[model samples]
Target: MRLINLKPSRTNQLILALLPFLALLLAYALGSTARLAENPSDKLLPALSSIADAVNRLAFVPDPRTGEYLLWSDTLASLGRLCSALGISTLIALVFGMVVGMFPYARALLAPFFAAVSMVPPLALLPILFIVMGLGETSKITLIVIGVAPIMIRDLALKVMELPREQTVKAETLGGNSWQIALRVVLPQILPRLLTCLRLQLGPAWLFLIAAEAISADSGLGYRIFLVRRYLSMDVIFPYVIWITLLAVLTNVLIDLVRIRVFPWSELDKAS
Candidate 1:
C-alpha cells in the first residue's frame, strides 16, 4: 500500500492523539521528581500534587480577602473581555468586509487604510489605548478588538472576493438589485468563512487579551499569573496556564460545532 493510503483506524487515531499529551505528563512528573529530590524547596517544576493543591485552593476555596473563588472570578473577567471584543470584531469584519469586497469605490477608499492599520503592531498601541481609554475594561476590550479585527476584516474580505463571479452575475440576471444580490447571495456564502476567520483569530485574540490584562487590570487570568510571579509561585502559575488552555480549547470546539450545525453545506463544500 502507498504510504499516503495507510490510514489509522478510529482506535489507533484516538491513541495517537493521546500519545503526545501522555508523554508530556510523564516527562513533567519525572522532571518534578528529580528537581524535588535535589532540593525540596524548589519553586520551579512543582510536583503534580502541589499543582493539584493550588487548583483546589484557587477554584474550590473562597478567597479570604474577597470571599470569592479566585479562579472562577478571574476566568469570568477574562472571558467577558474576550467575548465582548470578539463580538465587536465580528460585526466590524462582516460590515466592512462586505463593503470592500462588493463595491469597488468602497474598496478603493478603505482597503489601503485598513491594510496599513493592520500592519501596525497592536501591542505598541496598548499604552496609547490605556492613556486614551484609561485603564479599565474598555481599554482591555479595545486592545483585543484592535489586535484581532483588522486581520479578520482582511481575511473575510478576501474570502468574499474569492467567491465565484458567476454567482453574482446570475443573481443580477434574476433581476436582483445590489442589496438583493448581497442579501441573497454574498451574505450566505461568506458567513461560513466569517466563522472560520473568527476561529483563526482566537489565538491572537487571547494573546492580545492576556497582554492587556498583564499590563493593566484588577482581575483576570493573566493578571493573576503576573501577580504571583513576584513570589515565584510555579504551582499556581502552571495550573492557571493549563486552565486557560482548556478554556480556549473548549471554546474552539464549541465554535466548530456551531459552524457544523448551522452550516452543514459548508462541510459538503469542503468534501467536494
Candidate 2:
C-alpha cells in the first residue's frame, strides 16, 4: 500500500489512456446537443449524425466533379507528398548529418550555413517557394523538406558527435580510413538516431505540408479542410482533422516498430 511504487495494472493503464479521449467526446457531444437545441442550423457544433453523414459522403461517395472519393483522394495526395518529402529528408539527413558530424571540415563549412537556414522560419518562405517552384507538388514537398531536414540534420549530427570517441579511435587503430569509419562505424550507430529524428520531425513535416496545401494545392487533407471552412463545414473539417491525427499516430507507431525490429540493440542499450 506504499505510494512509492504505485504502478497501475494493464487494464487500469488502458482505461487511463482512454479516459481523456472519452471525456473529450462526451463533452463535445453535450455541447453539440446544447448548441443544436438552441439553433437547429448551427454549423459550429454539428451533431454526431451530421459528422457521420459527412464522413460517409466524403469517404463512400464519389465527387460529382471528379470520379473519386474526396476523402481517399485527399488522403492519398497528402500521404504521397508527406512520404516523398520524408524519404528525401531521411536520405539528406543520413548523408549530410554523418558528414557534418564526423568531419571537422564539413562541420565548419556546412554547420553554420544549416544553422542559419534552420533559423529562417519555414512558413515565411512559403510565398517564395510558391513563386519559385510554382503552385505545384514540388513546392509542397520542398516546403516539408525545408521545414524538417535541417533540424533532422542537426539532431543526427549531434547524435554522431555524442558517440564515444574510443570507438572511432579503435576503428582507426584497425586501419579504417575516414570514409570506411563513417560507413562502417558511424552509419550503424546513427541509423536508429535517424529514425528517432524522423519520428520527432513528423509533426512539423505535416504542418508544413498542410500549410502548403492550404495555401495552394489542388487536393490534400489540408486543402480539403480549408476548402470546407468557406462553407463552415465543421462535420467535414472535424473528421478530416481526426483522420490526419490518426495517420500521424499510425506512422509514428510504424516507425517505432521498425526501430524495435531492425535495431533491437538500440532499445537494449538505452535500457541498460
Candidate 3:
C-alpha cells in the first residue's frame, strides 16, 4: 500500500501514458469547434479533419515541382543530416572524452574549453556556420554537431571519470597498459553511457537541424513549415510539428532498445 511500492498494471499504465494526449486532442477539438462557430473561415486552429487532409496530401501526394512526396522527402533529408551529425559527434565525443577523462594533463587542457564552448548559444552560430561551410548540407549537419557535441563530450568524459579508480589500478596490476586498460576495461563500460548521452542530445540536435533548415535548406521539415507560414497554414504546420515530435520519440525509443540489447548489464545496474 505504500506509495514507493505501488505499481499499476500494464493496462492502467498505458492509459495513464495516453490520458494527456487524449485530453489535448479533446481540448483542441472543442477550441476549433468554438472558433469555427464564430467564424467559419478561422485558420488559426483548424478542424481535425482539415489537419488530417493536409497530412494526407503532404504524406501521400508527390510534389509537382520535385516529383517526391514532401513529407517523406523532408523526413529523409532531416534524418540523413541528423544521423550523420550524431555519428560524427559520437566519434568525436568518444575519442576526446576518453582522452580528457583518462589523462590529467588532457583533462586540465580540454575540460575548461569544452565547458565554455557548451555555454555558447548554438543558434547564434548559425550565420557563422553558413558563412564558413556555405549554404549546403555540410553546414546543416555541422550546425547539429556544434550544437550538441560539446555537451555530449562533457557528459561522456564525466561518465568515464566516474569509473572507480580501483578498476584501473587492478587492470594495471594485471599487466594492462593504459591502452589495454582503456580499450578492454573503460570502453565497454562507457558505451552504454555514450548512447544515453546521444539520446539526451536528440532534442538539441533537432533544434539546431531545424534552425539551419529553416534559414537555408531547400528541403526539410523545418523548411517546409517555414515555407507554408506565409499563408498561415496551421493545419499543415501542426501536422508537421506532430510528425517531428514522433520522429524524435521514435529515435529515443530506438536508442533505448539498443541500450537494452547491447548493454543489458547497464539496465540491471540501474534496477538494483
Relative to the true structure, candidate 2 reaches a TM of 0.98
58-171 in candidate 2: lDDT tens per residue? 999999989899999999999999999999999999999998999999999999999999898999999999899899999999999999999999999899999999999999
How many backbone clashes are present in model 1? Answer: 0
In Å, residue 128's CA in model 3 sits off its true spot by 1.1
158-266 in candidate 3: lDDT tens per residue? 9999999999999999999989988999999999999999999999999998888999989999999999999999999999999999999999999999999999999
- Candidates in order have lDDT scores of 0.93, 0.95, 0.94
Higher-lDDT candidate of 2 and 3: 2
How well is each residue in 79-135 modelled by candidate 1, as lDDT tens digits? 999999999999999999999999999999999999999999999999999999999
The residue-level lDDT of candidate 1 at 91 comes to 98
Work out the TM-score per prediction. 0.98, 0.98, 0.96
What's model 3's TM-score?
0.96
List of clashing residue pairs for candidate 2: none
